[model samples]
Target: MIELGKYAGTVLAAYGVSLALLAGLVWQSIVANARARRDLERQEKNG
Candidate 1:
């Protein structure tokens, strides 16, 4: 890697936090999609 020198720790921590937040958002979206699909199916079946 290039010489981040004194700022290396801070830079790496920021990257880690950004990646974690992105992963959480993706996971939440997938779960919400599945729940919505199930609800739709149930409603159709009862109609």
Candidate 2:
């Protein structure tokens, strides 16, 4: 395919940073959702 000669390093670094940020966001969202669901279930059970 595609050539990546002079700009290879910059492109790779940008992609790596973006991937890391996206992964972090996904993990945080999952944890928040799980916590919220557990809290709701607990309230329902107690009430």
Candidate 3:
């Protein structure tokens, strides 16, 4: 790990924010893909 010394808090906070945003993006994509797949299947069955 890079030694940030007194700047450690800022560096750690940046890493935390980056991880949270990445996690959110992954969760959103999964939910969206599942919803779209379900809709497509329903359309296929009805049409």
- Model 2 spans with C-alpha error above 4 angstroms: none
lDDT string, candidate 3, 1-47, tens digits: 88999999999999999999999999999999999999999999999
Model 3 TM-score is: 0.92
Q: What shift in Å separates residue 11 of candidate 3 from its native position after superposition?
A: 0.6
TM-score of each: 0.92, 0.88, 0.92
Residue 13, model 1, lDDT: 100
lDDT of 1 at 37: 100
RMSD of each: 0.7, 1.0, 0.7
Off by over 4 Å in 1: none
- Measured on C-alpha atoms, candidate 2 has an lDDT of 0.97
Name model 3 segments beyond 4 Å from true.
none
List the lowest-lDDT window of 10 residues for candidate 3.
Answer: 1-10
